[model samples]
Target: MNTKFGCCLIIGSFVPQTEGKDMETDKVKQLQAGLQLLEENGYDFAELTVQFLTQLSEEEFQQAKKIIQQSSLNIPVCNSFIPPQLKVVGPTVSIIELDDYLDLAMRRVREIGGEQIIFGSGGARTIPVGFSKKQGYEQIKQFLCRCESYAVKYGITIAIEPLNKLESNIINTVEEAISLAEEVNLPHIKVLADSYHMDLENESFTILKRAIKDEWLSHVHISDRERRFPGEVEGKEAMNFSKLFLILQEANYRGLISSECNAASLVDENALSLQFVKRTWSTVEGGIANVKPD
Candidate 1:
């Protein structure tokens, strides 16, 4: 499959935030500790959040950058592209604010050696009550265009993530995400397929075939229902992940498949999820389009 596996660090669980010099110290300490854990556990890269990267102070950013530069694990993909405060849709849409944030965010992403950022900011992109859905789509398209400008400058790709309707009011399907990405029609704008959301929406794995065909699928995020780490669900509760991996393998997906989930026990779950993903993917064989649940 030529796939590289990684895990997302839920920073809040691992790193405690503080104030003044202590904040910088905490951030650096957190980065060091997190990266060490990933590397020790055999992760190819680390998936971080743009929120975490952009919120850093100059000193903090520098310290964190040095830590990243020295770490064996690469930070190639980042999620949580926009925070709730930075609204990307609705009547309150602000190009100026969006531009300003992207300006700094893309630079930080590039500085930290990030190749792509997942656009899955549900809070920021949700259509407000009374706001026309049509208008919201236009707003999102405009936002992506703005993102494309910054992305091109920094050699970054923007992966438009389709959230489950529970998490977002718009772009809830892979087809919709790909459509929006196509509408944007920019080189740096693409799509991301998230297995957690797909399962939540009961979206078929066949959608990935179309995404792969169009080269719109740039990254992947995976987790079981209830946002548990992979392999946590078993028996009747288990998701047919083999089908998804087999589809991806047949399509020759060479991008990263990151575990994006909430775990009660981050340390142990991270290792467990990574092992699960590798072991599951190892069982995927070519020429088998249909995978039956075991």
Candidate 2:
């Protein structure tokens, strides 16, 4: 495994999509155990859902923070920035409440030592029917600009994630996200490249190379085609991560690569996925992936 690259262990139980169904007792234990598993298997950091983490009351936040600190793994990145009900762009939206919500989320993230937040909330950012795409684009730019303000206060960066078209109608590619980042033009705003979305969008790594060279790539999420742990993909069909890893290394990208996949066996799959990712990330060591700028 390349020491420069970092992996973010994203356990299923900690994710927001599953937050409501499970019992409180089971949830806490699973979260702690998953963190322990990641640390025991060589992962340095993990990603948490900002929305869910911020939903905790003050006391819960303190207790949760204690468990995380005790686990010895850092949380440098956060996912699920906005909740589904927040209409971020339409006329029926409540901008003030949304801003407050985002600020609260960032505050919680700052408290937990999170350095980056993923803006991949497909439902929140979606353009409503009958609205012009151009209008939606402008609104997104303004939204990100406001997000940058809050992010700056917490010493955090908002990583613009390009969701695939199926999940989002606007900003569906890294190229578009880069354009938005440039438009926002704030140091606290950046971009991310998720391999799963890239595959779904048919985005070639050639485009990602540009993000790396320009230093716009802030974080990454790696999952197999079926959204499973990389090596856990059965049969001969598997995504070729070697080129992507090489591109990231060649660009000298020192960002977090969180596993945002479905893990049937959290402990076992986390280790297996890490090992597979490490091997793939190692294929181009000392080559272009390891080049240093003069």
Candidate 3:
């Protein structure tokens, strides 16, 4: 695949594995169902949450791994890297805890053949009240530096995800993500572009073009304006996925693109969304105009 297309397996809202055995079993079953749907619908991979795998017990972790290993689709990408309790920033941050979390998270992701992990833990990275944005920025940069070491050790790439202001205080745009990733200056650390967040911020897709040009983009996430599945809307309310794919085509972006959104039905919604994206992509060609946010 020139540009791999996939979707985040939201399944059920992630419940901590410690919550209960029934919930744990439900999650595993949901994973099995979701993976089957993705493979059946022709998805290239499935995006899972890093927190889910990291929190699993040894046996549960092995079970989850087995489920993924048996699937036709690869779990090449994961999001929700750090949980809110981990504290990637702020004065209360603990280096020891962060290190331990990163060690386990990186190892687990690599074990499942994950190539990139999206760092979009808004709560974990948010600047606390009275905390200096400057300091928080530095803290995040330092955190990414720590992550780079783990990435190198595990042979996985870390994609710095830029959330919208409502979702995060820092790194609210692709430009900011690119700058941070550049300053970090590690081969294992790269940037990601999320269309939903970009629309929320009204950021121009032209910046994604720049990200592609500068080789800062490592992965992408797509959703409509309301955080609905990519194909949920059309015409005026629709996200111009064709333009987005055209940008990728023009720039020769060979990275992964996953839809991260909400939907009423996992099977129906994902299959429809997958078909919509594939249909739109099939019709796109070069010479399209720059994407200006509506």
Maximum-TM-score candidate: 3
Kindly indicate the candidate among 1 and 2 with the higher lDDT.
1
The sequence of per-residue lDDT tens digits that candidate 3 reaches over residues 71-140 is 9999999998888878988999999999999999999999999988999999899999899999999999
Summarize candidate 2's per-residue lDDT along 43-84 as a digit string, tens digits: 768787786576666766677788888878888888888877
Tens digits of per-residue lDDT for model 1, 151-205: 9899999999999998899999999999988887999999999998998888999
Model 2's lDDT to the true fold? 0.79
- Models 1 onward score TM values of 0.93, 0.90, 0.94
| Higher-lDDT candidate of 2 and 3 | 3
Off by over 4 Å in 1: 12-19, 286-294
Identify the runs in model 2 with alpha carbons over 4 angstroms from their true place.
1-26, 234-236, 286-294
Which residue pairs in candidate 1 collide? Answer: none
Query: What global local distance difference test value does model 3 have?
Result: 0.86
Tell me, what's the RMSD of every candidate?
Answer: 3.4, 3.2, 3.6
